[model samples]
Target: MSHLVRSGAWVAGALVAGVSLAACAADSAPRPIDESSPAPDASEVDYRDGEYAATGWYGSLPSHQDVALTIEDDIVTEVTITTPAEDPTSLQHQQAFADALPGEIVGQQIDVIALDRLAGASGCSEGFMNALAEIKTRARA
Candidate 1:
């Protein structure tokens, strides 16, 4: 019993020390809005240059959104989004997300973009990201 207690103490101390080290190493600095590393050059693009569109559906009620984007030199030069949200609340959130997405994605690489809660709309972001995946697939094809 005494040996067991000693071993438990050792383990607890080890865990505390490990956690302290990790906390010390962690930076409070938030991650950049664009989480990706460097993008490929124009000539090195694996995807073709063109316009593509996709529909993203998300949430329990199955809300969806449509997105159209143009890529030049593997970078998103233009983007358009259409939200078919019927519920007034849903429409407001979706509209807010739609309004903010272009500023976030334009002039950025397609593959590098991953949407978050833009304009305080998480559900809309889910739909938007879902749509972006399809656009990436079509662009790569």
Candidate 2:
């Protein structure tokens, strides 16, 4: 019926308008970085932490990255990242990779990082893995 058709059109238009308005009101601000955070002290780091290393290779990716993690008494004490190949325009991806792991992993021990369930920036999960691997290697040495 004509009445039903008109009601449907009106409902669709309202939904579209509401969605656009919501998108416009979203916060587009960049996340803040704390440069003042203290560096990991060797004295505080447990050199005898368990050695763990892993590499994440995705597809035919030409580049390589490395991550190292040191765990002492079931706690993560150190993490470092090395990049041999990096995409030029991927700064946000790089930072996300750096910030996601260390702060949380510092006092925890785990066999693997939960990459799939990461809140956002899955693209940098590979980089995070590299850093974890590097920590493992360095700790062993």
Candidate 3:
């Protein structure tokens, strides 16, 4: 009976040690980020051919802007901007700004450096630039 109790205690100790080691191993393993999470900032982006998107806000009113870019051979083939504003006037302004983006942005390399405001979309432009940086980070091959 004493021998049986001793053997049981030894087994329990071994089981606890095994579980502790497994927990330590799991804690040390690197966890992957979810796909929806924002990408980390990357310098000198080498874009893989795919569509990338990002969102940003600007100014006191804080209009939301979403920018999506389609890349082919490291060149921006298409650019789309969606700005949802609270006020009607703001919406119109944002829409016009979004409309002008393709003309200015298309045919350029994915590395957007100097985005200028056009057609009263200065605030949206700032948001667009911020989103562009995020897009570049995700574009790295």
Q: How badly does each model clash, as a count of residue pairs?
A: 0, 13, 0
Candidate 2, superposed: residue stretches over 4 Å from native: 1-54, 117-119, 126-141
| lDDT by residue for model 1 (1-141), tens | 011111011121110011011113778889766647575554454667877767677787877666677777778887767666778888888778877887888899777788778999998887778777776777784
Whole-model lDDT for model 3 versus the true structure?
Answer: 0.63
Worst 10 residues of 1 by lDDT: 13-22
Query: What's the C-alpha lDDT at position 103 in model 1?
Result: 82
Using TM-score as the measure, the top candidate is: 1
Leading candidate by lDDT: 1
Worst 10-residue lDDT window for candidate 2 reads 13-22
TM-score, cand. 3 vs. native: 0.64
Ranking of all predicted structures according to TM-score, beginning with the best and ending with the worst? 1, 3, 2
Name the better of 1 and 2 by TM-score.
1
- Candidate 2: count of backbone clashes, pairs at least 3 residues apart or interchain: 13
